[model samples]
Target: MKLITVIFSVFVLSPLTVSAAPQTTSGEIRFIGQIVDSACEVGRAGTLSSSESRQIELKPGLKLDVDTYRNACSHDALPMTMTFEPLKTSTDKGIVTITYL
Candidate 1:
């Protein structure tokens, strides 16, 4: 009985240790958005999706500097301006809104 109990207890405790093990996530601020005209000119009118937003981490009320990204959305001739706020919610995560502007 004692042997069985010890083995069972160890098995249960083993999972806790494994589950508590430190883990890390990998990825960058990824989101899909569209760009109007006014926003592209001044870097506004940009929106990001929540699902994609979760990919990155950010801090609450963290205002990020404007960033510019070029993408071929509709026609190769037309360029897309991607704007978003980068925030740091964790030590290894960041959140940003990517949109076509």
Candidate 2:
């Protein structure tokens, strides 16, 4: 009878002791990004300056016209053409063309 009781106690207590043991999980997380030219905000008359760094969010269909002075600001303003195309996923494909003029 004592042997049976001891066997039963061991079977039940073994699981409890095993479950109480500490568990550890390890992995790695990485972040990737890029540093690009800041956006230049134009004036009310639609003008941009070399000193200004403005950020603009482009949607599917939007157009903008901007004019800037030559080497007026620390950051010389440059003309760029950006085209956004929709892809199969939620992300979009952007095509950027920079012109010296």
Candidate 3:
């Protein structure tokens, strides 16, 4: 279970407030249960430069769907590598690679 996370933030100052969003950059977001860990390899990781820091915090709650990785059903259907549109209307794309046991 992996999710491409789009982080957003908000700030408040005595009833006046400002909002900020996570700068979106193309990257490979890996999902494990409810956690979306960022890539931490040497120099081959995805883009995080355009990603902006946040001012406000949010409840950590987003789970990548295993069903979202399901391939199209058909008689001759092969194991498929597929991705989907992001949830909460922000994610542009998602991809899933299936591994059998």
Candidate 4:
């Protein structure tokens, strides 16, 4: 009788102990944005769908050209400005300061 009681208690309490595992209460933030030159905007402001965004794959340490995405940009769209901001100047320096226009 005692053996049966111990087995039943073990089975019931095992699940309760497992279910009490710690859970994180924090939330996640996702930001998706794209930049284009004025010429590209004039010719065609391409749309980046969520599915396409997911399909884009970049290899580590590989740099991508913004012109690749600016397919509709005019050939005359020269002297474009591409600013990669919020970049650290050095390991000792913090995030780059940005001044919005």
Candidate 5:
């Protein structure tokens, strides 16, 4: 009976001792992108007419020249602009958000 008790105690306590040791891991996280300037109003040179929807659609890997939209910055807002250049290998297909601040 004493031998059985000893064996049972060893089995129950062995896992607790093994799990007490500290564990560590290593890896690398890389971010690929760019920080752009604030968006300006689309001017007369913009392709979309006033009656058209505000949304602009583009195929994957295509680039849009925001400069063509011209700078219609108002006196109340800061003068800033941006361009649209999709990554050549990017497969993401959705609405790209343009935040104004």
Candidate 6:
């Protein structure tokens, strides 16, 4: 399967060892992910430019549902033109396209 690169920026609060409280900084941050389609780009991409970053948190063992992509892309079909037709899977009923090198 082919994969695409995704990037994200994050901001977080710094912990203090003294009697002072934690502080947040607007600095360079980054995240990376491999996605199969475009819907994943729109749903998962974000910037740490505002208060939204303060409420966002990252955790280990994250999983994404395929239905999220189907729903988001339902209304907007990506424009494509191929010589051969796409094949649908018998099990999960997914549309698969083949490319040749």
On TM-score, the leading prediction is 1
lDDT of 4 by residue, 32-82 (tens): 456544322211123433121111112232222323233433343334433
Please list all clashing residue pairs in model 1, or write none if there are none: 35-100, 35-101, 56-94, 57-94, 57-95, 58-87, 58-88, 58-89, 59-88
Residue range with the least summed lDDT across 10 consecutive positions in model 2: 65-74
lDDT (Cα, tens digit) per residue for candidate 1, span 13-44:
99899767664548544444664532222221
CA error at residue 82 for candidate 5, angstroms = 28
Worst 10 residues of 1 by lDDT: 49-58
Q: After superposition, how far is residue 76 of candidate 6 from its true place, in Å?
A: 3.4
Cα-lDDT of candidate 2 = 0.48
For 1-101, candidate 6 gives per-residue lDDT tens digits of 12222221111222233215334458745444565444312212243222221111122322212222343333444333213222454432333332222
lDDT of 5 by residue, 1-101 (tens): 99999999999999998766554436654454565543453432345454322332344453332332323333344343334544567655333434444
- TM-scores of the candidates in the order shown: 0.26, 0.25, 0.14, 0.24, 0.24, 0.16
lDDT of 2 by residue, 1-83 (tens): 99999999999999999766664437554444563443434432234444334443456443443433332222554555444
Q: How far is candidate 1 from the true structure (C-alpha RMSD, Å)?
A: 16.8
Model 5 residue runs over 4 Å out of place are 24-101
Model 5 Cα displacement at 66 (Å)? 30
The TM-score, computed over Cα atoms with residue i paired to residue i, of candidate 4 is: 0.24
**Cα-based lDDT at residue 9, candidate 4:** 100
For lDDT, candidate 4 versus 6, the one ahead is 4
Judged by TM-score relative to the true structure, which candidate is superior, 5 or 6?
5
List the candidates ranked by lDDT, beginning with the highest: 2, 5, 1, 4, 6, 3
lDDT of each: 0.42, 0.48, 0.29, 0.38, 0.46, 0.29
Two-way lDDT contest, 2 vs 4, winner: 2
Give candidate 3's TM-score: 0.14
